[model samples]
Target: MKKLIACVLTLVLAVSAVGAMAEGLTFSWWGGDARHEATQAAVAAFTEATGVTVENTYSAWSGWEDKMSQYFASDSAFDVNQVNWNWLFSFVDGEGKSKMYDLNQVADIIDLTQFADAALAQCTVNGELLAIPVSMTGRIFYWNETTWQKAGLETPKTLAELMAAGQIFAEKLGDEYYPLALGTYDKMILMVHYLECKYGTDWVTDNKLNYTVEQIAEGVQFIQDLEDAHVIPSAETLIGDGADSLDKNPKWMDGVYAGIWEWDSSASKFGAALSDGQNFVVGEYFTDIGEFQGGFTKVSLALCIANSAADKQTAAQLIEFLLNSDEGARLMNSQRGIPLSAKANALCQTEGLLDPMVAEANGKVIAWCKNGLDPQFEAAALKNSDGVYADAFDGLSYGDYDVEEAAEVLVEGINEVLGA
Candidate 1:
């Protein structure tokens, strides 16, 4: 009987151990193959160190927003997932505020001070840290040094100089090479960049939503002129698809186009190409008017938090791990902007994975402006602005519309969007 009792006692201890090891966790994110591999490795490491069962949920960008909305609305959802920065305002601003976890509760689990001021500020609304910033982000000019030198033009610092360089590039490269490679389908993204050059601080401060009609007209005219001047490549000839231009042509690899405006991660493309004997460099932001002010900036990427969990403690642990761990920083590397955390930055340098330009741009990001505007307003302006480019490009190639009429039409469209 004693022998039977001993066996049963041993079995009880085994079952208890299994239960302890089964502590559940789930985290989701969107990215390509490399991000997936690195994130999985990080999770695996976390699990091995803590004996937790981590459920990884990840996908591409398409339909990611819809998936997140549904998950956030339902009870059966990931404990933590990646989100777009804009979504922070979407959720916390008016209606969706109540459905988030208080960062203070999990403060012991994660260190918030590690993140940069701008990134951290974006996550804070009404003095609450809604999400942790994993990376720094902004728009930047990426140029192919090889292509520019071949054209015999230095990198342009001002907008006027950029136009001159573009003409020279077009003259030399002829039809095969574009002075500036533009992702045509995504031209809407460029509208803000051009607007920044035209209006300066007024673009963000004076006319975030309420710009005078004349100002809008001026901004629209500026873009049309750039298109008319042949600075931007013809859409039909160069861009196959707007959404995936970076992956498809990878301007740095082609060695034909001079430069393109893109996000922080763009530098990595050049850096990656260099590993294979291709060389490139990141250029400073260029403006047409007075000293070039900083160009368009994105408010932030998504901040993630959990709604339901069997054990909030475990979920918090995982969140802290990804946000503050050196292993997590290396796993993501520069794939996500620069690390949002200063500690994360130091960790990356220690690992020899830091990108210098990205580090610099992260310092200049516009902060506390994540809210107080609507993207739909920007979208409307873009639709109207498109006409300016469409008319200019079509007229130049075919010689139909005169310069004055083309400029007038562009100005009119901007005025309409601005409600002037």
Candidate 2:
């Protein structure tokens, strides 16, 4: 009887020990190679320090939205998730509740003071701090100087110069080359910039379309003009090339596509894709376009804790380590753009971990942005799930619909999304 009791006690103690050491948490994110590598390193370092086990799920940008949507709907999302800034709006229901753990509730572990007020404000929905902003970003021009010089042209500083360079490229570099490469989403952003430049207004105001169908038609026409001038590749041509994304396209890597309007945070990946010795430079905003700056800046990505997480405290601790610790800052560097945490940003600077072009572009974009970004701007209805932006813009690009039809479709689709 004594031996039996002793054995049972030993087994119970062993189980308790295992439970104490099993601080398992799952983290999910989407990114390219650099971001994945950096994030894995950071997670490993955190695990080593805390004796916490972490399972990491990462992938490229493609299909992430649909995958995450399913996860959120099923309440099976990772304990810690990297979410788009705009997702907060859709993730919350009519009751203004979200499936995101309120970070403010875990403020003790996750150092909210490390972030700026503005950054924190962006993550708050219905008075709940749903997530923490990782970085601020805006789309801007990045040019391949090597390609431009080969075409015997300088980097363009104005819309007129950019248009002229298209003709120059066609003459100097042959029919296959274009001065710019833009995908469907890229076209939407560029069109917004042009419209804001021309009209001095925001894209949406108070959950409504700010521009009329006629004005939007003009924007679509401008995109057609660029395609006609050979300044940018046609949607049909890009689709026929069969590349999954612009970063993976051989044309972009080989300098056949000389310029991209991409997020400042994404500048490094695009630069890395170019051939060795190919120069990548940030181009100036078109000063001649308008009195107001044509671009908008907002949080690039946010770190959120899932409402269904089994261990909220452990998840919060992991977030703190990743966003506040000097070691985590060094490991992460600026792969997810610049860190939003003041302390992390300073640590990165002191450690010289920031990419120069990314840093410079971030500064330039912050200075040049004048408009407030809306969460609905990137709604799945507008951008992904048979999105209006893609349907109208791609139809126009493929010559299935002219400017007028595309404009009518765009306005109608946007209204359906906004319920206006």
Candidate 3:
């Protein structure tokens, strides 16, 4: 009887040790309700299969950055988290730094080679592969086909054509509608697309504040012509008093604007609006010069590990599962952008999980910074183009800025930001 009791006790202790080894690991991410639901489902499945418990914390985008900052500053590090590709440098830099695990450790598990060149490129800083990008973003021009016809023009194929179309809409539509709806609240996003189209991604990336005065003048001139022709509508009218007016802007939903410069992932949102009484179609991406064939670049949303983790191996497993697994690709679908992994993309395609337009859009995009820019330099140079186009393109209504002056001010602003 005693010998039997001892064996049972040994079994009990072994079970307890196994359970202790499989304790819950926490992962934090910021996403909308739908993303949270899908991602949690994926996590639950992963937990059940691996016999590991996962604790997830999800939040809206506005406060997510602060949440991450606090986590980084805390005693207990966040095990795994979502990070914007642009913001990766901020975390990995500085003294007493957040160290990223080498990708080579899990190369076989994660399949890094499966990702697109553009997506992989963005996630790589220095020589280390610090993160796995969940999806890629591409810039595209979205236009209302019905509105274009009303303005007595076909879809503009190039920048000149777009400007010409805008002039026609201004003359024809007048007060009934604006030629194009520009987001005043999120002016930076629109500015980046336009600046890239106008100057090419290379010029914008490489020049930074050091861009010769001529380049600034050229960008300003492009904006001036568009504004003078009434290509972009009044920012105040569309944006009201805030910095996030794209969804709330009636002109866009009501089918009054000619087009929009937005990300490809945004197509579905606009498409849904179209189903609910809005008439529109996403047009081909147009540049100031022409259709920018080389302008194709992917903006990545990366999954990164915090330097302070109790179990780096656990975090790596989560990342690997998400990037390389079929379930993970479906969970990330529209929320992340487009999956960067070849297997993930293939599985999504096979399952019909990908939106056709998104796939089409991805085929054309390239890396945002093809020349491999320093993140700080990229941020500074990007600020040069950010809202300058808004003022340059819509200065007539503001009456405080114009194309030429806005151009000069933009150069000064960029130069100042870059400490040039």
Candidate 4:
């Protein structure tokens, strides 16, 4: 009877030990279907290999930023997160303290040496390594060749040709087919790209607006000219489409919205959404856009561990596997942009795993865009849905604000955020 009791006690203790070792982590990110599927598969693989389970939450870009802001503010973020680079700066306190776990604590497991020092530097804040950068990205034009062909022209290689194609497209392919499309935020970024190229300066320097009121008005007018010339649909027309995103919009899928000033990292998602027989191609930076080549490259996204996580080492391990492991790298290839990890990049190039179009776009963005992005530029106050970018351009496009009035609103809003 004593031996029976002893055996029972042993079994109970064994089960308890198993339960203690079975802790799982929570991870979250925002992306399209391809990214969701790939990341889920990678998570499953990591779980199978290490018996470390992960629960993942994901959604498209629409409200993800606001949701993340809430999580971070409450100090209740998930164990791991796929973060926008600027979040490192945006989420910090006045003293520069961050809610991210100091990655130096988990250096024993993660291969930090795999990334470039310059790349890693951008992700650090207040002496804390806030995140691990996945890739660098910059905006460039991507065109649907089938749509351009319908207008009887090749994709434009110069700003003049691009503007000319707009009228030509309107004449030959009906008023519904536009040469390019720019949402409110898209216009904001493109304005910066235009101003940078023309003025040869960063949009923000030393936490102040670089352009004077008149210079900003000129930038706003340039966007207005595009709308007037039919280079892109007016705000009203695009809003009428009623699609959540350009990728889901019917006109884009059917080849009516032919060109986009989009991030290079987004090539696959956008291209895959096009109708069968349509071709998506990386386009050249127009030599005539400005006197100097402009635009800026930034850390497209990153992997981070929350300081509030119950298992910091486990979270770090997950990020390491997703970013640096052979299998993980294979699954995640070019989904987040070109890999910033030297090992992953070399492997992708040698094995031909990197998407050819993505590589081509990244090469062009890196070579021609000569400015560095300011972290404050992507602050939620400016870039979030229904934010200032909308306040300025939406009013301008709807004729509620003229060129000078729109510039006033834009400068005021930008300064408000920067000054804060």
Backbone Cα, N, C clashes tallied per candidate: 8, 0, 7, 0
- Scored by lDDT, the top model is 2
268-317 per-residue lDDT for model 1 (tens digits):
54445432444566666654553435354554454456656567678777
lDDT of each: 0.60, 0.91, 0.63, 0.90
State the lDDT at 269 in candidate 3.
60
Clashing pairs in 2: none
List CA RMSD, all candidates. 6.5, 3.4, 6.1, 3.3
What lDDT does model 1 reach? 0.60
Given candidate 3, what's the lDDT at residue 195?
52
For model 2, how does the per-residue alpha-carbon lDDT over 1-420 read when each residue is reduced to its tens digit? 999999999999999999877769999999889999999999999999999899999998899989998998788999999999888888865566798999989999999999999889999988999999989999999999999999998999999999888889999999889989999999999999988988888998888899998999999999999999999998889999899888899999999999999999877888988888899999989987667787789999999999989999999999999999988999998999989899999989988899889899999999988887888889888898368988998899888899999999989988888889
| Per-residue error (Å), model 4, residue 75 | 2.0
Q: Which stretches of candidate 1 lie over 4 Å from their true place?
A: 1-23, 92-95, 116-118, 126-128, 184-190, 202-210, 238-243, 250-253, 266-276, 296-299, 360-420
TM-score of every candidate = 0.74, 0.94, 0.77, 0.94
Higher-TM-score candidate among 3 and 4?
Answer: 4
List model 4 lDDT by residue over 1-420, tens digit each: 999999999999999999878889999999999989989998999999888989999999888988998999899999999999888887876667798888878889889999999899999886788899999999999999998988899999988999888889989999999999988888999999999899889989889788888999999999999999999999999999999888888999999999888999876788999989999999999888779888999999999998889999899999999999888888888888999988889888889999999999999999999987889888878886778889899999999999999999989999999993
Candidate 3 lDDT tens digits, 207-238: 45434656555655554465567787665555
Residue-level error in angstroms, candidate 3, position 255: 2.5
RMSD (Cα, Å) of model 2: 3.4
